[model samples]
Target: MMTVNEVSKLTGVSIRALQYYDKIGLLHPAEYTEAGYRLYDDTALERLQQILLFRELEFSLKEIQSILQSPDFDRDRALDQQICLLTLKKEHIENLITFARGLKQVGGMNMDFSAFDTAKMDEYATKAKEKWQHTNAYQEYTQKNKGRSKDAEEALARGVMLIFSDFGKCKDGDPALPEAQALVKRLQAYISENYYQCTPEILQTLGAMYGAGGEFTENIDKAGGEGTAKFVERAISIYCK
Candidate 1:
């Protein structure tokens, strides 16, 4: 058996982090000392090792917890899956390193990207499906946004980006000014033009998501600047209200 500190040292994780894991029920101690110190037996250590390995392979904490705690989880199957993923990652990283080293040697750029491994492309698609399935809001967004044409959507998108760009210039928490309101109107018209029958409910929900969701945050930040998405979202809320 090992104390929490010993386990932390062995795992190279902080003692505080181990304590947090224990608190969160992610990796509880196998035993407790008379002095109330946490202790980990061989089984607990093994579990910790698996958790660490899964984390290193880019599984989220929640994903790891679900997999570990699931009734159908098999140790051999888990190990096999981890090995497959890690091998793919290793191959990709090796290719990137080779490319970088070659670039360093050649000085000027004449590199071909045709050697890109497309074998793991389906992994991202699977992950995206799983992510969309996890949230009703995101699923709804996907349903609404999916299958919309590029040509039809581009005008609306341009209008929305302009609003976001203007919003980025404004101070946070300030009331939506006349110019913002006018932009919101244009955005609503654009949505109506594309969405066939844009209901207030759908518009309101979308506006709320744009205001609060990290997806919109990233989108707006990418387009204009950080907080531009939030500002546009707020303005949409005001206009819709």
Candidate 2:
């Protein structure tokens, strides 16, 4: 585990920015020390890498948060897109550099402006953004959350955490038990009612995320207990089956 200061030094992200990210639910540390200092594990660092890559693509903090939190977010697919975008950006820069050097050599205005054309890169970025943001579930979430007050959104988020806290109460019980399964159903219903439809497939994905040892797992465990997130994941798996 690394302290927040360590992470800041390693990633060159300001400590204040990291704190803001935590406040806004962008990227949470893996755990906190008893002294209230933030600590991060490898999983958190990996997430930071993703965040940086998205930032390189000029995604807004809100957009990055949404994409990272999406149920359909695929890290590998995101990497692929990031790679393509970076490659295009690199080529564009190289072309511009060559064009500038040619202009300097001629010491006169060049009519050729093709080096500045970014239509292809811009088109790819637009398509990639659409792929990441225009999912039916995302559209539905946007529609449902339209005009929602900040307090209302916080209340809804608290409601979900409360369900996880309830899961903590039964962490020692069998996940296949009716009690655990019922909670899983309740969670699915709550998400579907307030956000997007929680199909079994999506729930399964969320379950995996809950236990995947990153911010989601950290938040769930914080709401519940140390093992509550893993227990909830198991319960959801059984419920989905």
Candidate 3:
């Protein structure tokens, strides 16, 4: 058991914010002591952890409460998802900083958007690819994606995009219907064509990763809308089963 102050100190959230959360029922204490002092237990501590995660994800307090109180709420899953998002945000910020530095190197008084040339991008790709080839993570990704021709991979990507583009047009539970099932089959076939025997577990994990990670979200959302990504995730989940 811990007091509100203890939780504030442990989490680096201000004491006032913790008190406000209690008042708003966002992270209420387990019970109040006889003297009216708030008391929190293990469950409350865990809830606080979730609230902190929402803050890090830039969710408003109201949004955090709704998400936490949802039937599908899962702290570990939320944390895992936030970690993926933060990682992608970190990478994008780094890239932007590097681009800014490149502009500075070209003796620009300010960010010279005009100086940004796509034609010069190929000059950096060789070094970037060489660096990735030497990294364990890139090597693993390469081996995982190997054996598929570039053209075949591109076609598979297109098939997946087509499914995303048409997301949410069908009625609820339509994924089990003939047309939806056909789409799922097409997606499954694309995976099989690109990779060596994508197992059921692999398919399920890929769905989770898609929801958890920002890059996957960006790609799927670009294919259609944000709902399209969620629909793809649900379809993948059902197909994997």
Best-matching candidate per lDDT: 2
Clashes of each: 0, 0, 0
What digit string (tens of lDDT, one per residue) describes model 1 on residues 30-98? 668889999887768877887887675566765565555432234575566567767777778888788
lDDT of 3 at 82: 63
In the range 82-193, model 3's lDDT, one tens digit per residue, is: 6765665566567678878876798746744543443334433334334324543334434555565546645755877776666545524545566655665666565555
- For 1-241, candidate 2 gives per-residue lDDT tens digits of 9999999999999999999988776787877889999998888899899999888777888788777766988889989999999999999999999999999999878999999999999998888888878897777787787677757877999999999999999999999998999999999999999989999999999999999876788889889999999999999999988
Candidate 1 lDDT: 0.65
Clashes of 2: 0
> Considering only N, C-alpha and C atoms within 3 Å, which residue pairs clash in candidate 2?
none
Candidate 3 TM-score, C-alpha based: 0.41
Model with the higher TM-score, candidate 1 or 3: 1
lDDT of 2 at 199: 94
Q: Which is better, 2 or 3, measured by lDDT?
A: 2
Task: List the candidate numbers ranked by lDDT, top first.
Answer: 2, 1, 3
By TM-score, the better pick of 1 and 2 is: 2
Model 3 error, position 202 (Å): 26
